[model samples]
Target: MSAVPILGVIEGFYGRPWTPAQRGRLFARMAAWGMNTFLYAPKDDRWHRQLWRDPYPEAEAEALRGLVEDACQHGLQFVYALAPGLDLDWADDGDRRALAEKFVHVQRLGVEHFSLLFDDIPYAVDRAAQAREQVSATHHVMDTLWPDGQAGLLLLCPTEYCGERAAPSVATSPYLKALGEGLRPGVEILWTGPQVVSTEISVQSVREVNEILRRPVMIWDNLHANDFTLHRVNLGPYAGRPLELRGLVAGLLSNPNNQLELNTPGLFSLTDYASGKSDWTPEASLDRALEVWLPAFNTSSIHRVSLDDLRLVSHLLYLPGGLGPQAVRVLDVARALVNPQTGAEEREALVRELRTVRHRVITVLRALEAGPNRDLLFDLHPYLVDVAEELQRLIVWASHRGEDDPEVFSYRGSLADRLMTLGWKT
Candidate 1:
């Protein structure tokens, strides 16, 4: 059997609503690039409200249907993304029923592909209650909407950040289990594993979720989206280059939010890359990763010397020795010292008090490694080699620390200053 076509972004071309002219142009462009699917789910677009309950005036509804028809003619499936949880906040039972009615209405529009987007809903809510309610409502509505029970494809976005939020590593929530039970057999789950923007997926976890949910898992990768604290690390091409997110999956979806400012050529090239038509090499993908990660590294670049530059010194010392529990703690301290948060400053008093302590510790280690101290050096050399390997990783990660927190710059700057004073080389 052939692989399912990769889905590309359908939201915000040029960072704004696609005027009719723009939509037509984009539709043709997408089809030409071998992209077969476009997810039409815009967060801020009120016009999409027409897809539910005929909210749009007659003329507008006709216009939307026309767009759908055009998409079908071009051999592309336009997936309607219904913001059930985000837009239709079901604070009460009535709101839930109303949402169901809207789903029924949209089903009448001959729209085959549908997505129940529960993403971005507050996780603090009674998740179990929300899941059951959504499942029951969806099942009930789709029953009435498609009496024959032959609904086309259904996509469900569970209440977590699929590819952007990478915590709660395990997807064994009770709410999710309940959702699986309530889901109609034909429903396809858009499973967002706990690893947001994760290049390496835990296949065991993937298998576990599939077995539990009893649905084919389609990975929703946010390759083009850049969310640092929440979802840092861009996974897609940045400069009209291809960033192949290689993975063993049933299908791939590029969930680009409103951030991508892709030009026509860039868009087409990305579409080709996603569709697996273009030659996407691993080297090319790594190059794209570097482009996205390099800027962050620049913010936290460290000079060779400046042991007084606490963070860099700690990085240099800690990495080569291996990342022990104490090592991690010291590095954290160095990081905090260099770019002390307001609260950190109030507690540490500019980290001056700890300078002597840090220097003493390094001096002792160096003494242990002295040439005449053969036994100590012999024991420490192996450990130092191990530490060096880990330190290299730390350096690479520190170089990009600014991607998540720009404040890491303060540490980089102070480290550079200390290095210059100490006459250290890069």
Candidate 2:
């Protein structure tokens, strides 16, 4: 009936350090936007460190109490993350007892939800079984330590791609299924289906896994966090920037999960979702794209480029790979569409020139086939061999000619040159 509740993870597992005041402000902002859950997963914060075990420093404990109190005041649940999965060094009984004490203390502060991270924790050297045991032991500790056997919901971040098989091979599937089944019964599983990036996963695929594990599965679909590196926003290079919000909304509505998160960077991705620009004009969309790109493109040096120039550039290069050579060509065409820089007759001639070049590139790509020439491509292809084959589909899309006498890549390797040549003020 109502929209799904999205959990905005503040002080994520990775990011710039946030002061208490900063965290309080972040929570308040999420609350203002109707967010209901906050997952605190800072790796080396003082509150969750090994030293926190000592007589439970009153001042530090009270500071945490204030965070929890602030969250409740804004109608949000504060999910404290214990480092057992990723921080197994802190999983020893002594450390566990200390953490248990801290958890109990936090309960008194009115915080109930907690998460156990097992995702990025390095595997043990000798036997793989030992790593699984280590994770189980930590869950066992939390199961017993929580007040009344269920102080709050326990969120498990298992080792195998959030409990999905890496390959369909029998050897791997059995191990993943076992890990999923082995998790505590009442605990909620944070499953990030196979890949952490934006992916097309069906509801049926999710239901099958949930049936096998016999537990409620929470989808942690990372539609934006591609490299596992946080802070890079996922707005499209040009016009598609606002369009990305549609993909995010589709993912949210695709599956009605009790929880959803904007896993991109900083604020929300897509200006429409972030700043709420909904006019949908060719000129307006270009301006939004430049607002995102100019800062990222001109990071190293001072550049005097107005937002209008950025808008003009972005409207032309709206391809998925962003403002690459292909996008630049597209921008040139879009500009030519309205008014030709040279002349009316010359504008038609420019389009023909671009089309001829695009035709040649397409022939070159189709010849590559597979196998030997695969290594010629860049991006996640060679690194993640499986996804490389899929990249071939992108070539055709990227090769499409733009309207303005298809802009040429004069300096093949220079990103700056490509931008400057395509009418972008340098």
Q: Pick the candidate with the highest lDDT.
A: 1
Residue ranges of candidate 1 with Cα displaced over 4 Å? 10-15, 47-54, 87-93, 108-110, 161-171, 199-205, 226-250, 257-280, 285-426
lDDT of 1 by residue, 1-426 (tens): 123445555462123455555566567766765667767766555644433433556676677678778888878787776765645555677666776666655555656777777666666456667778778766765676568975566667677534333234336666666777888877667654545544444566666666656665676654344333221212223222223332334455655433232223224435445544456643343344334323322232231212223222222332111342344565665455445253644434424434444443444345444434343334234334434333332333334432333223244456533453341112
Give the per-residue lDDT digits (tens) of candidate 2, residues 305-406.
344433433222222234434447644654564352457576556556445434433332333323232322221122222112212222222334333233
Each prediction's RMSD to truth: 16.2, 13.5
Using all chains and alpha carbons, the TM-scores for the candidates as numbered come to 0.55, 0.54
Tell me model 1's lDDT, rounded to 2 decimals. 0.50
Best candidate (score: TM-score): 1
Give the backbone clash total of model 2.
5
Q: What TM-score would you give candidate 1 relative to the actual structure?
A: 0.55
> How does residue 48 of candidate 1 score in lDDT?
49
Clashes of 1: 11
